[model samples]
Target chain A: MANHTSTQASFENQTTWAGGRSPFNVSYGKLMMWIFLLSDAFTFSTLLVQYGTQRFSNVVTPITTKWPDPASIFNHFPFMHGLHLPLLFVSVMTFILILSSVTMVLAVEAGHRKSKSEVARYMIYTIIGGIAFLSCQAWEWYTFIHEGARLDGNTFGITKQGYDHLHSVGFGDHFEWADGDRTFGPVPFAALFFIVTGFHGFHVFSGVVINVVVYIMTVRGVFERRGHYEMIEKAGLYWHFVDLVWVFVFTFFYLI
Target chain B: MEFYNKPGDYDAINYIPHTESHGTKELWKTFWLLLGITVLDFVIYFVMPASGWRNFIFIFFGLVKAYYIVGAFMHLKHEKINLALVILVPMVFVLGLISGLLYEGSALEVMKSM
Candidate 1:
């Protein structure tokens, strides 16, 4: 322990840090959070990049079959089923996430002011927004599995539905799964959707849980006693990162 | 002050960031800006077919949205240069990865053409 401390001190002395608690004027906790989030960013970027690679690579859209378009898959909205609105519900879900990011920022601001009630309010709103986004994703996933009728399709597609109404109207019989030489995977499209969106949905679930735990702690006066609401700020960082990743996912997976 | 106070301190508030009271106005502004951009993104997608230019604009707006969230909401714009670079520098590698993927993907497309 003594040698470790001396070596750490020697390293600090070798640098211009001067042995202060924070090396970059940022608290140790916040800096560590940023570094962790940076690594997580790389993970997501790699996932999406691989998605792009697999999507464009090895995709031969024969006249008899075309890859599944996102707009056609996500067209169904609640109670307005048959409207053929392209990307409407997905856009709504995106805005819900963005709105949650806003609430999280407000919660961080309130934390800066050391206003407990304000923090609780904003945190609750943010949590609610997170839940709403999760609900939307669940519905989207359900619709995908139900409509595509791929029971053992991918690792993520769990449920199955008999009827696919979109097939009756939009791009009828667009996939020739029997042609092994043409399609990328047995069902590459479904596989990619399940992997990318399922991973993102998992992140949302964790973020919501983190927010709830932090909200409870805020209500319990943990940060108030600790002299700062930095935990809330950290949570806000994670929530915003989730939103940021979703923005890229929407563009790459849905639109482009 | 609560953590560093040497007993009998005058300030009662246990604040961390000695903020200058800018309030949440900027948060609201960024929210509106992001919302407007999102709506515009969808509208652009709706109005325009998925052409080269359309895809470029879609990715451009996505990048802008990412910047807004990181800069405004996460307060990276206000942080130190080292911390900001710590996050941004790794992102360039992501760009590299995407470029490489694009090349490989286009190669596949070319093969399909052939």
Candidate 2:
């Protein structure tokens, strides 16, 4: 009888300990996510700083005629009328990303409840949101490329008058009219923009792929078997990191 | 089957109450505050006249939004204060670097115009 009583007590103690334990005792996946976010933040900050430096150095040029404006550069849509939309696509992308982050949080919450169905639903939403954002980015890139905004060129296909109008407006006001003859050679600015933003977009794409795989396993009840939503929480960290990077991008690329 | 009915069976069972899973009203309150900051940023950017005051307003709103993003979204507020400081100090350095570079670049531009 004493042996049985001791075993019962031990079981109770074990259950209590496990129940009361904090999520912090989980593995290093979430911690590593945070570190990755910090390093990625630094990479974006450096790129933006460089952009700012270049912009400031060129500020003395006549704002009306010489500056390249981001609004004009990114204004095209294939099916829409030739409306000079400013940051519309980017705004949509931003909203999609933010919504994805929200879905990610919901997924995390579902994970906490061990609600596999809820987790799968939210994860699907998150993936959809990510895909939507990527599609918008691709469209934006297509427009940019179609408009002849090459990395090496004297005239990025923007007329001097258009360039002036763009400069008078706002951020992305430092781009210049590529020389008309296409003889002025490649401008390094376009390359830099592509590199930085492309790298970020690549991160987003990879994140979406990872979440999709996780979602599949979620549907198969893998995490349910593990008896915890730690994976959801880790994925939440990644989603939030992507959103955080966009906050900086919006500031440096748009608002500033 | 033996392990399933082990003495510590309940310990292996994870049960998270729905109430604990869905953050309480406190989280909503924080979300509202962040939205308010975002609105303030937009207002400052669009409504304010271009001047030193406008610039100040923009910077202030930006910092506020950044603070909330770091504190609330990143859960820095729940961390040890020293951890917050460690993370924030490097950000401060980056900001300083930005300002210095902009200043030097602008100065050079001015000199070139002369």
Which candidate number would show the highest DockQ if scored against the true structure? 1
lDDT of 1 at A192: 70
What's model 1's lDDT at A20?
35
TM-score of chain B of each: 0.77, 0.65
**Clashing residue pairs, candidate 1?**
none
Lowest-sum lDDT 10-residue window in model 1 chain A: A155-164
Residue A6: error of model 1 in Å?
20
RMSD in angstroms between candidate 2 and the native structure over all alpha carbons: 6.5
Question: Candidate 2, residues A1-256: lDDT per residue as tens digits?
Answer: 3375565466446542364422333234555566677677778778867866765565524423232444455655446545555555565566677667777777776777778999999999999999988888888877677666565542343445555454465542334333451222225446656766787799899889889989998999777766666777767777777776676665555444
- Proportion of native contacts present in model 2: 0.20
Across residues A146-207, which tens digit of lDDT does each residue of candidate 1 receive?
76535346322111121133344432223321223222223556777778788889999999
Candidate 2 local lDDT, residue A123: 97
Could you give the interface RMSD of candidate 1 in angstroms?
5.2
Per-chain TM-score of chain A in candidate 2 equals: 0.78
Q: Which stretches of candidate 2 lie over 4 Å from their true place?
A: A1-27, A63-65, A154-160, A163-188, B1-62, B111-114
